[model samples]
Target: MTSLPARLYRALALGWLASKAVVLLVNAVTFPRLHPSRPSLRPRVSLLVPARNEARALPHTLPGLLAQGADEVIVLDDESTDGTGIVAGCLGAQVIRGEPRPDGWYGKPWACQQLWRAASGDVLVFVDADVIWQPGALDAVLHGLEHTGADLLSVQPRQRPVTVGERLLTPLVDNAVLSYFPYPLIGLPQPAASMANGQVMALRRRALEEAGGFAAVRQVVLDDTEFARHLKARGRRLAVALGGPLIGVRMYASYPQSVAGYAKNVLPLHLGSRPLLLLSAVAHLAVYTLPWLVRVPGWRVLRVAGLLERVAANVISGRTRPADLLEGLLGPLTPLLALPVYARALRRTVSWKGRTYPQKAR
Candidate 1:
């Protein structure tokens, strides 16, 4: 007979799994997805890329942006040691030297503020330098913004994780969004339901100005979500969508880079509360790991449910890689691998792109 404590744990695990299953069911239909649209009624667009030591990445990503038919393409070389500015200029983008980030400002937000000031377009598209903009990507995003009547549209570009470590960890990023967020609430005008992806975001210039622009989130490392929340709080229209083949990003090249990259955002995701972070780690281990290892009640059922949820998440999020479905089966291992990330995020500071920022819950 199962002991009382064991039975209780089983109940909790099964309950959590069931909750995620329900979320997946809802998001399957309601989640917005983007596909390439024919350019029409074109608004003046300023394509902005914030690059830091991204000389190598610019060669692959910048060409796509330049070909997007934007009124102007601008790349801010954020004091990169690697000839980021020169490469962007050669690629036919108007390169701007970013001013040094002021005290109490995070690097990306500071760089973005400079880009925002320089842009003279009805639509402001902020894209990371590492993203690959497939043909018609910008048009589709703009169409999404206009169709939804949103002031800001944040897109989760399809992830292309090639390495073993990347395959293991990267798919989980979409899982968090696809399996948790209440999709219906996302459309409602409320800050609590807001979400955003910094990988690719398109904003109307007027909406950005009303929301106080990038300066509103200058200090926080998780600038995207905070900025989205700020916009939503001020009654700005917001939308989140999946970028199918139209946009792609390989955010980290190796296992270690993936670990460090995730660590920087993990604490911020938990709102910088040590107790909350600790609780999350323990909950993930219990909810994700124990269901696979122990032959407890409903263990096999839980495993199958978890895998299906993962695969469904991939499909719903527009991840087209065949490997992603296989990686979905490896979803249970993500919590175990993310243990190191959780540990690193517990520190007082985190580093990214040669800059270290003090971590604090705002």
Candidate 2:
């Protein structure tokens, strides 16, 4: 027999699911797509990639950018122990050695600052080494920027989670961008409504300048988020689109790598405050794990709705697979699976790609 607390939990979970479902459905109808643009006046685009020990990904990613007909493809080799510069040079990219990291500057923003200075195009595209772009993605991004009149544009790529660990965690968070935030507000005149994915960001040169540029945000971990906020602060538009078929990002290679990769970014961002973090953990557990608390077929309505909401959100976002759709129904297991990551974040030490960034408690 189901207890009183269990019954009450399911009811509350249903309400949360219903709200998220409404968000997913509403954003799907309103969010813009990035198709080809044929505007008469097109800005000159320079593709810049900041790479640190990314030799494994360069060969596959470079060709995709080269095929885009971009005016230039420049790669900043940020003191890689691997022959990243040589690999970029061999692949026909204009390779530049990134300057040493300044005392307070983070590695990525420092690399990006150098790349932006070197780029001569009116438009600058910062692509992550691991992100793969389709043949005409650049044109579509240019089109999206022009159509929305956004000073900065970012397309959250279709996340391909091949590993078992990824199938469990990836799809759930994938829904975050569209599931919670209002699509129209992202471009409106409010920093509160802005968001961006660092993997593939395109910005107008003037907009970056007016927004205080990469150097201004050099020490920040949430670089893309700050970019969106700054751009919106300058009264410039910022657009975020779903890049389903046009782009794909392979986030991690294995389960262990996935844990580290996610914890480094996720923990600090969500768990910065002790009270908020504790409240968030409990809320996540109460809602997501609520379905797991009871396994009866009759009371599975809340679980079913939660699962379907995730599936519908992913499908609407344009990154759904048949397996992932079914796998995502187990969405309730996410917060539980992510417990270790949450714990690691609290420890104040995070590692990524051979670099260690110690988190300073707020």
Candidate 3:
């Protein structure tokens, strides 16, 4: 017979697992899918790319983007020392020289602002430097926007985690979304439920201008999320979609790079609260790591729940390859791997792409 305290602990863990399972089910059923649909009225589209030290990636990505029937493809060379501008020009992208970051402005927002100013299209599409645009991706994105009548349509690119380290960390991105928040809430009039993926965001040119453009989120590290929330607060219709077969991105090449990239955003996720960050780390370990290592009562049930959640996340994100399934099986150990990322985020300053910024406080 279990002691009362042990029984209470088991009940709480089970409850947490149950709540997460419900969220996953909601996401699996309600999350929007991006598919190619021709609009009745064709809007001129501008594909915008912000490049910094991305000369190597341009060759692989630009050609596909150019193939998309856009009015123009523009690339802002964000002060890259690696001839990013030259590469974009050679690849047939209209390259714009990015200006220096203004006071209290982050690099990405500044670059995006310049791109917005230079763009001449009714539909403004922002693609990150690393995103790989698949066939019919632009058409699918336009379809989603028109069908949903969304002021801003943000699509989550299917992650291609080629490296071992990438496999270990990338699944958590989908997990963070599908596990914590129900997808339906995003369609409701709730600003707090707002979420966005900067990798592939499409907006109406007028909607963007009405929201004060990228200048509104100039200082935010997580500019995509903040901007989405900003639009939501003003009663703008927002649509979230899975990129599926149309879009993909490989964010980092190795484990060390993954760690550094994740660290830059971890603290921001917690709103820069030290106490909240520590608490989240402990909660993750308790729920995800402990069951694998400790043979406490009901550990098997907890382990099964964690595995099922991981598998569900993989399926929803279109990670059905055998290799991807294996990575999903190892998702339980990501909490242990993330401990180092949390530690790095706890530092006063974090660096990315040759720039360092002080961590924002809540």
Candidate 4:
């Protein structure tokens, strides 16, 4: 016989599944498909890469970027001790020395602020140094923006997962993003629904300035999401797409590094609300672990619930099997992994790239 709590949990799980199914259906019906043959009519674009101790990855990433037919590429080396500027410069990108970061600024935003000021192009493309662009990637993004008349176009760069830990964590991150934002609905000019990826973002210069540029979100730990919110608030049209063949990113070299990387932003996600952080952690556990818990009843029921959860998570994340299953198993543990991150975030201080920033309360 099913206990009351187990039955209640099952009921909650069913409700969650139904809600997600509706979202999936809506997304399927509304998502816009990119037409590859369409040509972009926009003016030239400037590709800006902000680098801090990214020398190891720049060599591979820069060449891929250079091959993308952008008008110019500017690399802002933000006091990197690893000779990132020299490497980027040697690869044919114009290198600029980033100004000293002000108190309210984070590393990438500080560099981006300088790059935006220096760029002369009508369109500005901010790309992380860790991303590798494929051929026609730049053109596709430009075309998508021109066709949609969107002020900003961001792409979800495909991430390369080389290790077991990466495979587990990557899907969890992707699922969290998709579940939170539901991309298809986001592009429909709604303020309440908006999302963007920091890996590769393309914005019109005028639109960026109109949205208060980087200065508006300088103090924000989650700059990408904050910028998207600001743009929506300003009524600037925005669209996002999966980067199909356009770009790829290798976020971390090892498990510990990946955990630390996520910690850097996960806490500030709550804007310092401990309750919200705890709630988020609990919700994550429910979504990722409930299927497994349901399995304790019997193999047949467990198999069915596991399959349903996997399908739901897969649709949300756009990731494949085996990997998704692995990530699902690991998702419940994210709260534990996030504990130190939340503590640091609560303390309003986080260290990244060998530099620390005191968190400013929202």
Among these predictions, the greatest TM-score belongs to 3
| Candidate 4 global Cα RMSD | 3.1
Worst 10 residues of 4 by lDDT: 296-305
Cα error of candidate 1 at position 314, Å: 1.3
Q: Model 2 over residues 201-233: C-alpha lDDT tens digits?
A: 999999887766787677667678876777777
lDDT of 3 by residue, 140-232 (tens): 999889989999999998888887877878667888888887888887788888899999999999999998889889988888989999999
lDDT (10s digit) by residue, model 4, range 281-348: 67655654544555633434433543555446555435565655455555445545555555555666
Each prediction's whole-model lDDT (CA): 0.87, 0.79, 0.88, 0.73
Candidate 1: TM-score? 0.96
- TM-scores for all predictions: 0.96, 0.92, 0.97, 0.87
Candidate with more favorable, higher TM-score: 3 or 4: 3
Backbone clashes in model 4, listed as residue pairs: 348-359
Residue by residue across 64-123, what tens digits does model 1's lDDT show?
A: 988889999999999999999999999899999999888888999999999999999999
Off by over 4 Å in 3: none
Residue 146 in candidate 3 has what lDDT? 92
Native-vs-model 3 lDDT?
0.88
Error of 3 at 234 (Å): 1.5
